[model samples]
Every structure is written in structure tokens, then in C-alpha cells.
Target: MTTAPTVRTSTPEERFVAAFELHEGHTLNGSNARIQGLRKDAIESFKQLGLPGRKDEAWKYTNIEKALRHEYRVLAGAPLDEVALENLAPFLVPGLEAHRVVLVNGRFVAALSHIGSLPEGVIVTGFAKASEAHADLVNTHFTRYADFTTDVFAALNTAFAQDGLFVYVPKNVIVETPIQVINLTTGDEDVLLNPRSLVVVEQSGSLKLVEGTHTLTEAKIFTNAVSEFFVGPNARVDHYLVEDEGANASRIHNLKAHQEADSYFSTSTITLSGDLVRNDLHFLPDAENCETHLFGLFLGKGRMHIDNHTLVDHAKPNCYSNELFKGVLDDASTGVFNGKVFVRPDAQQTNAYQSNKTIVLTEQAQMFSKPELEIYADDVKCSHGATTGQLEREAIFYLRSRGLTEERARTLLLLAFARDVLEQIKIDALREHLDARIAARFAN
Candidate 1:
């Protein structure tokens, strides 16, 4: 018999703080006044907030400290000339024809990316170049959406923000081709990466963005990424994030969006593999007649840990929002879902709904689901609920009696259960790819 390796619970604050100090001058030497000021303030916030432990209310269910037991080399973004386009074949969605953007070790590599198919007004490039070329636009919306004062990971990512993805769509223009951003981690050393993205869609503009992460090496990689989106009036944005990493990878992702009147914003998060993964998603519908939607699906096995924390703020009258998250845990894996909807006092006629469901496949598997609604408006209609249980044995037995094997019957039932959230994905190729992946995961 083999025993699992012990994890050290020591804090990694000092290591990161030292790395920041060693690289501060190099990172902020030629930046503008506003950019420099934001970096300095962000580092101070990171120092004050530090890393969260079990005592933190928001982090009570996830043990992130245990996943930080690696001696990671805090590094900045750099182009990878060694990686070729052929190396990305396995990570891409099959049969999808879209403009592809590639990032290696959190830095955008233009040589490996293909974005010529996009329209004239659409702007897609690395954050570093965008900050220099389109300084005014980047400065206006960079740190406006994703606040780092209360969240430690967001603060850290802001402090070290250098290169990632930057997308812009002009007013009244529609982008027909989907923009795919692929973030890959390679190399044999343990390291920590901070990536940032800022997307702005002007009035009446439309866009479809897809982001994914994959690990190509067996080394431990910790990725802390922050993305901000500004949806203008009558604009539409569909965002998707897919995490398909190895057991040696851990990720902390924060995405914040601000929607104007009559705008539509939706996001789907799919977690397929990882050692420890946490997603912090926030949507603010600050104007009347705005619509927001959030969906997530996670499959955990082999001691994997997945945590999702989401907040939908209904600050204006007649706004609407809906959320649904589901999980399937097997072996000794664990999952956490904490969804919150806040309706302000002036948000009259606001309609918000949230639900979380989970299926535990083994006795040792666990799931913590918390759905909350805090409504200060008397005329608001808000509801939230959670459910966690196992697959119905009667259904499985009934399928088996129809000449199907027990494993096959169970796989079919699980697929049907996940179809609700999967069907919500708008991208046909991406949805089909995920369907095949999920089927293979259960068929084995």
C-alpha cells in the first residue's frame, strides 16, 4: 500500500513579498504615472490583506494554504520562441474555426497566435502592447472593474500585472469570429504567474471570447489571473473559461464585469482537471434593463479540489440575473459552490435566481453548497437554493434491466444530469468538444 504525500501548511507570503521587492524597479521603471501609482497601491493592499486561511469566511471551505507548499520562482512574462504552433493542437477545441491567441507562461506570443481573420475595428493583442499603443482606453478601464482592496489574489495579480489578453470592439461593430485565448504552462521548474486581461465593448458592439488553460509539463504551476470587462449600452458579450490542467497545477482566477443599461453579459466556467482551482466571478448590473447569466460545471476526481465563488449585484431597477452551478465528485475529491445575489434598496422589480446541485459518487467525496440572497428592496423577487446527493439507484437499476451494463447506465444518467448547464453554452464547437470530453471521463 502507498500513502499520500504530506502537505506543509506554512504561509507563502514572505516568498512573494521578497520577489516583488527584487523585481519592482525592473517592472515599474518606464511606466506612466498612473500605472506606477496603481502598482504601488496594489502591492500595499496585498501586504495588508495577505493570503487567506481557514479563518476567512469566504475561504472557510477551501484550504488554499495547503496547495502553496511549493518553492515557486516568482517570474514575469516573456516570449517563448521555442514553442511552435503545432504544440497547441491538443489544447484547442476540435473543429472550431476562430481567431486564436496564444500565451505561454502568462505572456502573449504573437508568433504562435493567429488573429488576421478578425474585423477592422476589433483590437486583440497583448496587455503590454495595448497599454502602450492604446494608453487612454487601457487606462480608463484597466483597474476600474476588478478591485483589489479586499481580495488578496486580485491584489497580487494587480501588483504584478504585465502581459495577458487585451480586447476592444468599436461602437456599433459586430465581430463574427470568436476570439480564443489559450494560456499554456511549460518548463520543468515550479513557478508563479500573474496574468491580466481588460476587455471593452462599446455601445451596440458584440463579441464572443473563449479562454482556456492547460499544462504541458509535470512541474507545479500557480497561476493568479484577473480579468475586467466593460459592457456598454446595448452591447453583448459572451465569455467562457475552461480549465483543463494536470494534477500538479493550481489556479486562482478573478473575473469582474460592469454592465450598462440594456446590455447582456454571460459567462460559463468548465473545470475538468486540476489539483486546486478557485474562481471568483462578479457581475454588476448597475443600470436598468440589464441582463446577466452565470453557469458552471465541475467534475472532480483523484483528490481534486474545485471552488467557485460568485456574486451578482443588482443595483438598478428592472434588472435580471440567473445562476446555475453543478458538480460531480468521485473518489476522495471535494467541491465548493458559494453563490450570492444582492439586491439594493433602490433595485425595485429586480428578479434574481440562483441554484447549486451536486452528486457525490463515493463515501469519502464531499461538497459544500451555499446559495444566498440578500434583498433590501421590498418589491424585488429573489430566490436561492442548493441540493447535494448521490445518483438515484432506482434509475440506474432500471437502465441496467434494459440490457445495458451498470457502468454504461450510470454514465448515461450523469450525462443527462449535466446537459442542462452544457446546453447553455452558445459556441457549438466548444460545447460539442466538452460533451465528448465529459462522456469519455464517465465512460472509463
Candidate 2:
């Protein structure tokens, strides 16, 4: 009778290292040279960066210590029994027709996915498959846009980037059908997931992508996800991320994008539910005549916490960028919004705007908003503003005087307050689905 070897690990970081070592031999054995190199580099970077704490200025407002207390293991589980098409009905946006891609516990599930007819030269598949089939393309943009050296969660995600989603559109091609990725977390024990995605749109090409996260189990889940988008010259890309996880789940998402000359890139982040959620969104308009837009909406209740940090870097001349983020907090929930716009010295004729607004429904609910602008170019136009307050009593009273109940009047006012962010959604079906969801939320 021999005793099994002991895996001594204390902190979450140490446990992650141990987990990586355990999975390195089997799950990472067949990876290509470039991927292997990325994993190695990422591990070293993680070691140097470690996990952030309250001292980190960027993460000061979001306290994740309690969320990281569990001993979470990374599971490359696929074809999970609990993840069937029937079980995904609640997650799918009604009346939205699109190609569906499903991932369970960070691994792609082909059985539950549907890839419809795509235009010629447009490739959409699992990351692992793309790595093998389009090695050159994957290698060129996998770790190029999202910087892992400075971000600890990004480094951790890169170290565990075995599989997720991959999309590529060749030059001059347009994908009519939107690509919808549903990320599901289901397990009996606490698990950590790293879902990595890379999307590339070549010059003159266009694409629309939507990614949503959902939880199917009550187990504690920590998702550290990284997604990179590349818009080539004269190309356009629209992206959306919907986070509606369970109360026992926490997520850290890092989204980075690079836009070339004459390109357009827009992203909207809708955070509906989570225990602790933090989103780091960054965009670099590196060439002239590039356009970027960032929009976010977060609704927090039941002691949940949501943090949104965004940055737009104007590195070239004649670029335009705009950002708007709003939040509604109730029942002791807390929210944070920190947005920054940086204009380089050579970025002349740059136009940048940022705004953040929040409504606190209860005295216990709190909000922190910080909007900043750093313009080094004299020819640039940059502005930022933030506001946090409760719903106007006059508006609610007026509706009540019009023969409406107090609760109904309050709900209507909140819905009107959130319309700015909701109206930005280009997809009519998706927008309607979210509008209904929001209305129901306030109605209840």
C-alpha cells in the first residue's frame, strides 16, 4: 500500500502553479512550438506579477480576496453531461438568429455547437483546432494584442490558454451571420477557467461577434478570460460581452483591441449578475483615421460588486474615440467605473469623449466613478465626466401622480435612465431581448 504524493499548495497563486504543472504534461503535450513558448513566457510573467491586491491602484476598488479564498482547480473538462442543448435555452437570446459556439469548463464542445453557412474565407472554430489548421495565422495574433506581462490575470489566462474560440475573416469578406459564443461553467467542485479567444478581421473585412457567460451549477467558479480583437486597415468589427453568471461565480475579463488606419472597432459590455466582476477594457488606435467606441451597462443587487476599467489610447493623428458607462446599484451592491483617455504628443486632431453615470437605489448601495483624460497633443479635443445619484423624486412623483404605483413609477424611471446604453446595441433582436430582461428585472 503506497501513499499518494502530497501536492502542497497554500495560496491561490501557488495552487494555480501546481495545477499548471499537473496539466502541463498531458493537456499541453501536443501543443505547437509557439503555443508552448507562450505558456512558458506566461508562467514566468505570472510569477513576477502575482495576484493584485488593494495596494494596486487599478484594483483598489474591487476586493477579490474573499473570492480567491477557495482552492480552485483548472479542469479541461469537455462534453460535460450537464451541458446539453436543452439546458442552454435560458442562456440563448430569444429571436436572435446566429451561429452558436459552446464551451464547457473552458473546453469547446462540438456536439452542442452549430456553425452555419459562412462566407468564403471566413473561419470560425475552436482555438485548438485553429492552432493546428491555421498555425501561421494563430501564431501571428494569439498573444500580440493582449499584453500579459503587466496584467496578472491576463498572464494567468495565457498560461492556461489551451482552447476557447477562434474567428478569422479574410480581406474584403463580410460575415452576415453573427457569431455567438456561449461559455458555460458547470462542475461539482470549485474550478478556475481560462477561456482565450482571438478574432482577426483583415483589411476591408467586417464581422460581428457576441460572447456570453453563464453558470449551470452552484459550485464556486473563477473565470479569468482574455480576448483579443484585431481590426486591419479599412475593416470594421463590433463586439459584445454579456456576463450573467451565478452568485457563486466571479469573473475577471480582459479585452484588448488594436485598430489600424481607417478602421472601426466598437464594444459593449453588459454585466447583469455575478458575485464579483471586474472588466478591463483597452483599445489602441495606432493609426490615423481610426474610430473606437466603448459602452457598458452594469446592474448590481444582492451584495454583488461590479467594476469597469477602460482605457483608450490615441497613438496617431485624426483618431476618434467615445466611451459611455452606466450602472444601477441596489440592496447593498457596489459599483466602480474608471475610464481614461490618453492622447499621444503626435496624435493631433484627436477627438475623445468619456462619461459615466450611476443611480443608487438604496442608501446602502455605493458607487465610485472616476473619469480621466490625459491629452499631450495641443490639437486634440478630449473630455470626461462622471455623475452618481439616486433617481429624481420629482420624476417618480410625477408618474405616481399620473395614477401609477410607486414601484411601477420607479421601474419606469430606471428603464428610461438605462435607455442610453441600451439604444447603442446595433442588433435589433439582441437589443429587444436585453430590454425585456431589464424591464423584467425592475418589474420584479
Candidate 3:
């Protein structure tokens, strides 16, 4: 078993801290002083906690300390040529009628975005423009959902939350088409980028959001991204996160959501590739009669490491939640899944189920899975389990006997294993897009 590397020096983290400390003064002078106060408080909280390390339980398996040892250039409104986006043609999702928002090096680029016929009450704007144009919405819900007090990376992101996407749906309104937010990172030197998003759906409102990350350059990049969602009573939202960043990058994504009574919230994360990636997904069923579901799939190869940590907090009575995460690792890559379902004392009659399944093709590839449930209520039905194994040898042999090549047979079985979760994605074009990506992944 290989162990996490030791932190050789604290200089890199210290420089980041210094940079953030310097940002506090500027981040607190906005039109909404309350938002500034919130930023100030967040920076102070981050100063106290610093960055997470191997000592933290939630980050025990992720060697964040060692990952940040290398020097990184933090870009501020970096210049990106419009012509440079031609290389990103392969990442687009064709046949999808959608409004797209583009960001380069974590900054919004209006010239590159496609803003379609968005109806009234549907606020789709850049985080900066929305912060100024829709002050009420930004001031009211921007920093309310994610708990940065306990999460260090979240705090860091919030402290540096300059540009991203803001989607808001008013009561009784339904978004006509899906909205896609594409974040593209590019630079010459090693860079650290933080992209933040806030989404709010009012009572009886509905929407579908697709968030994608793509790297356009070969520079080493580290991304700390945070997104928050508030589902009002009876509202519905389908959220999707697709991570296709380049090979030389590290990514940490934190998604925090709170669902009200009778609300429906569903979120899925599809991680196709990365160097070191960690996803912290938490859902709070805070009111009665709510339905929540979480799904994730990660495929890694060649020294990559991916971890999915999820928590479902059932705080009210009579809520239902289902979760499943699957992974396929090869070429000495490592994948980890830790999911916990918590049914509080008052969360009686909560029906929650969690499961994790993984396949490691080579002996060098490793998968570690842990699924847990802690119930304090008596009338709750909660179950959790995890399974890890290699590709079924019999299935491979059967396919090979049917005139398929060894690599083709292996790819078929791998796709079969991931099909159950992929089918759950409701967007047809997106499903087809992911299918092509998966085939290309295994074609190598």
C-alpha cells in the first residue's frame, strides 16, 4: 500500500494565505456591505482554520497538504484570446438547445457566452453582473447555503469568490431550456482558480442546470470550486456536474444544498478525469416530505486519484433519500468513496438508502469504499453498503468468444457496469455526449 506524501514545506500555503489576507480589504468594499462583512468574516474563519491536511477526518484520505506544496500562480482577470477557444471544440455538447455561460481562468467572458431567450423572472447572469444588477438576490442567498465555518476549502473559495454563474427562478416559473455553465481554465504557469456559483429556486419553480469544467491549456492547475443550492417548498431541480479537466490539474468541488418541505432535489457528479480530485457533497432534508437523490461516477487512469465524500442529513420527519456512486480505476489510479447518512432524533420515518460499487482492473489500481448510516430515530429505514471488485472474468471471456477483441470486451463490460447510473441522467444529448467520452476513455 502506498502512503500519502509528507509536506516538505509550508511556504506555498503561506503565500496563498497572504494573498487571501490581502484580498479581504478589496472584497469588503462592495455596494452591499453585508456581503462584504460576510466575506470578512469568512476570511477570518479561514485564517483560523488554515488549509486541511491528513489530520482532518473528512480529508484523511486526500493528501491536500502535499498537493499544495508546489508553487501556483493565481490569475486575476487574466487575458484570454477569443480565438484560443477553437481547441475546445471536442468538449461541447451538440444537439442541445441551451443557454451557455463561459468562464476563462475563473473569470466571466461575455463575448464567448450565448445568452438565449430566457423568460422573465429567470435571472441568468455572471456573478459580478448579477451581484450589481440583482443585489437583493445576491445579498439574500449568495453565501447562505454552504457552511464555510467547518470547511476550509469552501472558506477559501468564498474568500476568493469573484466570478461564476448565478441562476435564480422565481415562484411559479419554469425554465424553458437547460442552462449550461462552462468553466475553462488556461494559463502559462501553474495556477490556482476558484469558481463559485449560487442557485435558488423559489416555491413551485423548476429548472435543470449543467455545470462543466474544461481545461484549455497544459499548465498545471488547481481548482477549488464551490456551489450552493436552496430548494424552496415544492420546488424541483436537476443538477449535473461534469468534470473533464485536462490531465495536469487538481480539483476540489463542494456542493451544499438544503431542501424544504415537499421539495424534490437531485444531483449527479460525473468525473471523467483529473490528477487529484475531491468532491464534498452534502444534502440537508430540513423539512418534512422531501425527496432527495445523489449519484456519482468516477473513472481514473494513470496515477490519478479521485474521492467522493457525501453526507445526507435527515433533520426533519418523513423524508426520503437515495444515493449511489460507482467507479472504475486502472493504471495505478486510486479511487475512494465515503458516504454517510445521518437521521437525527426528530427525523423519524425517514427512508434513506446508500450504496457504493467500484471496479479496479489492475492490481496497481486501488479502490477504497466506505458507506455508513447513523440513525438516532426509531422509525427510520436507512441502509448503506459498499462493494469493490475486478471486471467479471466470465463476462469478458463470453464477449471474447463472440468475436470481440480483449480491449473491446473489457470496454463493453465496463460500460455495462456504469450504464445503470448513466441512464439516470435525463438529458438525452448529455447522455450521448457522455457515452462518447467514455468510449474515448477506454479506446486508449
Candidate 4:
């Protein structure tokens, strides 16, 4: 009989526990002992779960063990300086006066941010600070909506989440300006960046938020980020995310959003660069009359890997959801898309649609797309489709024959293909900013 070779465990869980304990002593001044206990519990949960491997269903496509095997050195504390701000200047939206919230290596940097005059009832601040200043609100919604058990990374984030952004918009308030979070990573040292964002829009409130991520250092790094959004009854929110990181970095991001009755939520994610990136989005329409729109674009080159997994759950009647994801794979890159829509038994009159399209720019590039629809109710409308193909050589040749350079022609065609998804972004300033970045990415 043949026996399987015994596999050795990499690192002890106690190492992470010890590291977390060292940081836990630095108490957040305004938070009470109970909230601190919750933070400790989160870290303990993460230590137990550790990092997910290929055996895990959600992480099967993008293996973290291979991408992130080295131990990340916890970054030493430092104030935000001009050099850090200069490194991030390129990512700032050109002409919009945005409310900037800056975080460096997962720690809030107040000096590097520009805080606009918020509405009377709106509150935007660091999560640790919010826990101290507004403990009740922070305690109520911090980890209330997300299911940490199913998502090990989220539990890890909650465990190591010491500093991050917290935004709360009260009932009937509309924040005309967009809240911009620029998460800058300086890879001068190896570090584990655990970034957490909590957004709560109360009944009838509205908000627009934009998040940009960039790496300043050339050293290898890993980013483990989690964001939770809550949309109250009659509230509406539009969110945008742009990630342009260094090619050697690895990123794992999770977005979990919950919607109440008569609420609306929309998200557009643009990923232009990264060595290995995995994005997981979950939308739960818990009440009736809820609507959601999710769109994503990923452009990769030079052996990069990008995976996007999305789920829309219709638990109540009369909810609607629309999803579209597109990818452009060049060189030897790989792209994976898995989108699932579930309509519960009680979700009568549910409407859901999903589509994934990919353009392979090189013979070596690969793409895998799976769009699934699960409908339990008898009266429901749900459909899903996916496609993978090479770029249209005929169109490229036609453009080239019209006096356009081959490179420029290809860039223009790719831009046009991506425009359909970019145009869905409601914020004009952010849209233009992203367009410029996309153009610049192809210009090289």
C-alpha cells in the first residue's frame, strides 16, 4: 500500500496570536473594554482560520499559499510625510475636490488627508477613532452584517483591523461630494496590510464613494482588505474601486453589502495592475423593492492573475439585480470570473441578470468564466451568460489600414470595448479620472 507523504505545517498559529497581542495593548482611547474584547475575538478567530488554501472553494481559482508564503514584517509606526503623498499624487482624480481619507500600510494617516466640510449629520472618520468618539454606532454596525464564518479572509481582516475608515450618513442627508480613500502601500518592507472600511447609509440617505489603491515601494507585499456596506431603507449608494498596484504584490479584497427595503446599491470596480488579485463581492437584498448594479473591468499583462467572484442573493420579493464583468488578458496572464445569483423560495417576482465577457489579446493568455443562476421561486426572471474569445482581428486590421498605428488601433479598440462598462459609473469626475488612467495604462 502506498502512503501519502506527510505534509509539514508552515507556521504556528501562536506566532500570529503573539503578534496581535502586542498590538492590542495600544488601546484606542475612546473605546470601552467590551469593544476591545470584540476586536480581540476577531483576531483570535483569524489566527485559528489562518490563510485559506486551494482546497477552499472561494480560493480555489487564486491560490494564496503560493502567492504569499513569506512572513510579512509588521510595519513600524510613522506619520504621513511629503514623500508618501507624492508617491500617491498620480492616483488622485484630476479636477474633483474630493474628501480624501488616507491610510498608509493599513494605518490611518490624518496629515495626508483632506477632510471636506461634511453634511450636518454625516460622520466620516477612522474606525478606531469612531469607536472612541461614537462607540454606540461603531459597536452596532462594525461586524453586524457580514458572515465571518464562511469567509476566512474576512475573519482575518476583522482580527487584524486596528485602523480603517468609517462613514455614516444619517437619514435624509445627501452628500453631493464623493468620499475618496487612497490606500497607499510602501513596499520598502514586507508587511501585511489589513484594511477595513465600514459604511452605513441610514434610511433615505445617499452617498457616493471612491476607493483607490496604489503601491509606492518596489518590494513585495501582501494586502488583505475587507469592506462592509449597509444600505438602509430608501437609501442609495454608488461606490467605485480602482486598483493599480505594483506587479509583485498580492491582494485579497472582500466587499459585503446589505440592502434594506426600497434601497439601491451600485458598484463599479476597475483593476488595471497586480501580480495576483482576488475580489469577492456579495450583495444581499434582504427586503423588498431593493435594486443592485455590479460592474467590473480587469486588464492584465505579463503573467498577472485576476479573479472576481460575485454573488447576489434575493431573499425578498420584487428585488432586481444586474451584473456585468469584462476582462482583457494580454501576454501570459490569466483571468477568472465566477458569478452566482440565488433567488430564495420566498423571493417571488425577483429579477436578476449576469454576464461575463473576456478578450484574450495573446495566444498564451487564458480566461475562465462561469455564470450561474439558482432560482427556487416559481415566478422569477433570472438569466446568466459568459464568453471568452480573442480580439477581433478584422476590426484591428481595418483600423490599421485607416492610417492608425497597430498599437494605437489596438488600444482604441480595447478602450471602446471597456467603455461600455466604464460608462455605467454615475460619478463624472471619477469616470474621467479612471478613463485617463486606462488610457495611460495602454499608452505604455
Question: By TM-score, how accurate is candidate 1?
Answer: 0.96
Off by over 4 Å in 3: 1-10, 26-31, 77-88
Write the residue-wise lDDT of candidate 4 on 1-444 in tens digits. Answer: 113554534552454565566666563222565666766677667766777778977677787776655666443333433445576678788877778898777767778888779999899888778777888887778777666655667776666676788999999999989999888887466677777888999999999999888888777778888888999999999999998889977888789999999999999889989888899899999999999999999998999999999999899999999999999998999999999999999999999999999999889999988888988999998889998987688998999999999889888988888988999988888788788778877767
| Model 2 TM-score on a 0 to 1 scale | 0.96
- For 1-444, candidate 3 gives per-residue lDDT tens digits of 113665545565577777766655554245466666676677777787887777987778888877877667554445654535565476679987788888777777777788777878798877777788898888888777787787878777877777778889999888868898888887667878877788999998999998888887788899988888989999999988898888888899889898989999999899988899999998998999999999898998889999999999999999999998999988999998999999999999999999899998899998878898999999988888999998888999999999999999988888888877888899999988888778777767
C-alpha local distance difference test of each model: 0.89, 0.89, 0.84, 0.83
lDDT of 2 by residue, 1-444 (tens): 113654534777887787778877577653578888888788889888888888988888997654675667676533355676898899899988998999887777888899888899899899888889999999999889888898888889888887889999999998877899999988777778888888999999999898899999998888988888999999999899899999989999899999999999999999999899999999999999999999999999998999999999999999999999999998999999999899999999999999999999899999988898998999988888999999999999999999999999999999998889999999988899999999999998
Q: Could you tell me the lDDT of residue 329 within candidate 2?
A: 96
Q: Give the TM-score of candidate 3.
A: 0.94
Model 1's lDDT to the true fold?
0.89
Q: Model 4's lDDT to the true fold?
A: 0.83
Which of the predicted structures, 2 or 4, would earn the higher lDDT when compared with the native? 2
* Ten contiguous residues minimizing lDDT sum, candidate 4: 74-83
